[model samples]
Target: MADVVLQTINLTKEFTKRKGLSSPRHFFDKVTFTAVRDVDLTVERGEIFGLLGPNGAGKTTLTKMLCTLMLPSGGSATINGYDIVRQQNQVKRSIALISSEERSFYWRLTGRENLKFFAALYGLSGRAARSRIDEVLELIGMAAAADRRFQEYSTGMKQRMALARGLLADPEIFFMDEPTKGLDPVATRQLHDFIRDELVRQGKTVVLATHHLAEAEQVCDRIGIMSNGEMKACGCVSDLVGEASLIEYFHLLIEESRLEQ
Candidate 1:
């Protein structure tokens, strides 16, 4: 049997939006927005599972819930056999999150310095931290440039540094949200190759939340198509698209979701 590293059952998230703070009646009245609804999925160890969706489609929301960054309003999930809610710390220890936000790092710090700081947060210090930081820097092909300030690096280099930081924990699973968001074509392809050739080779499962259809088809072993905060379809690219192009099928799924709503 395949080792299921991550699983979710009816996992959902809802946010309450208040109409107006000025009015007493409006204060009591709230509109609920379901960011993710009844999302059921499974990701096996060492396989790339893509959450393919456009912005506001709840891919990031779901990823956040799984990473234990945000609490789920309903349902449940597990990471590496630990419940995400009850065993939050264990779940966090087993997973690393890499987001597209470039501002999360200290701009004044050099790449190696940034990694060293984060490594301390993960409880690594002294020679161990240095050795691990060196390993990940080399793994991300940032060894030579590790001493450069983060603000001076190119967009692609910044993203690679983010990847390096994620690897510091040496977690079993990685949650990457729009990792290739601002990259040009060449950079995006290079990142994709690094994900497939390097990360997977290290026996890590990746939960990639991305809007890029081509990226999903190329990097994912299996995909879950999410629209309007729900999973519309899931399977291998060949199975999900069949005779139709992935773009065509994606549009079809979105339209069908709209009609259902």
Candidate 2:
């Protein structure tokens, strides 16, 4: 009975190696790699939740499942209390998905052109979509470069543009994975400001997945650390950190995970 925007119940995903030269043809090797397993995560309404972990800790996989990019092998999840497996369409509409340097959008198109296309897809057309695009551009300080080709845009600009696409739908939930991955300190600060200020001010729920424990500690009201497809702990920064400084706390958190079998 939690006022949660996102929740997962024993969620799991498993992949099998298809070894071509194995004994069996189309070898379905008994080897099972669990990318994510038995994870129980909850994001409260109007809070920025952090999914903290190192690379290959399955943060991206978890984000993808939440955003409906992939199906989990077991358990159930809900977005806005709409079952992800059942009411997927509704879930998709309410969720904004962003990732770092993976699948994105038209590099050939101008920044404005790109936003226009997504706005149309989200059913915002003509004046309404234009208005929204302008709003986000101004919010992200990309108004001046709105007409520039995405290929010519800086890394930070591209990140902001990807974020704008997510906002075009006016979604209530945002799933961002390593959003500030390749940016410099200044750009990272700017992106952090948007997530911490703009998103929170609007009462949006965010689930941020990143390796930067320092930033996560600063922004997340609560954090969950994962390793080898399982979550180690989940709680507020002060709750987990206790006497240690934020930097000291992150090392302790990581060390705790590494100690687990």
Candidate 3:
């Protein structure tokens, strides 16, 4: 087996109810919501692993926990051998998260400027930052619109630019949450090709969290299906689903689960 670049053992997250301003405590009355529940997963180096689920199935929450954007309420995870909590700095340095949310970027800055700024955060300066920024923009096919104000860019363009920013640090592990959310067919195919080709050539491990079953089957080496904050099934597309498409397998599994419930 290839080296495990990312792993999570019983990883979980819980969101407690907010407390109103009161003299006495509301901890007893607080309701806890489990966003992710005991998710165990592994990703090998240079592999494309797809995390597939319907919306609100805890896909994004699991990614956030692995990437260190949000702390896991319980259990543990490691990225490139660094603990997500104790070794946060090392974990952060080794991974990049490309979320679908466009609001994370500075709307006033041009696409190039945004990359440059984020590159600086990773300690790249002077020629190093400029070169890296340009390289990523070209890779994402955003070079022509690199100077356009982010706010003025189309939704697809903004998503592309966000992807460029995520690669600025050249991290070992890439976590993408619905990366092709706003892209057209051509752009989506292009992004998928780039991810499977260029990034794979570089031996980067990608954890793609998306609900697109066909897209996952096309690009991922292995797929893990999630539902109601739990992992339902996991394996290679060929072995797990056989001749049937992923959608068919997924529906079968969902129906089985519903019957059990």
User: Per-model C-alpha lDDT, please?
Assistant: 0.91, 0.87, 0.87
Per-candidate Cα RMSD to the true structure, in Å, reads 2.1, 2.6, 3.3
Give per-residue CA lDDT, model 3, range 1-261, as digits (tens): 669998899999999875555424773476678889998998899999999987777899999888778999999998899999999999999998988898999999988888888989999999999999889888888899999899999888888887788788889988999999878998889889989999999999999998888888899999999987889888887877785666876776566556644
Q: What is the TM-score of each candidate against the true structure?
A: 0.94, 0.91, 0.90
Which of the two, 1 or 3, has more lDDT?
Answer: 1
Task: For candidate 3, list the clashing residue pairs, or say none.
Answer: none
User: Over the stretch 136-219, how does candidate 1's per-residue lDDT look in tens digits?
Assistant: 998889999999999999999999999999999899999999999999999899989988998889889999999889899999
Best by TM-score: 1
Kindly report which residue stretches of model 2 are placed more than 4 angstroms away from their true locations once superposed. 22-28, 243-261
Q: Which residue pairs clash within candidate 2?
A: none
Ranking by TM-score: 1, 2, 3
lDDT of 2 by residue, 134-188 (tens): 9999888899999998899888889989998888888999998989888999988
RMSD (CA, angstroms), candidate 1: 2.1
Q: Which of 2 and 3 is ahead in TM-score?
A: 2
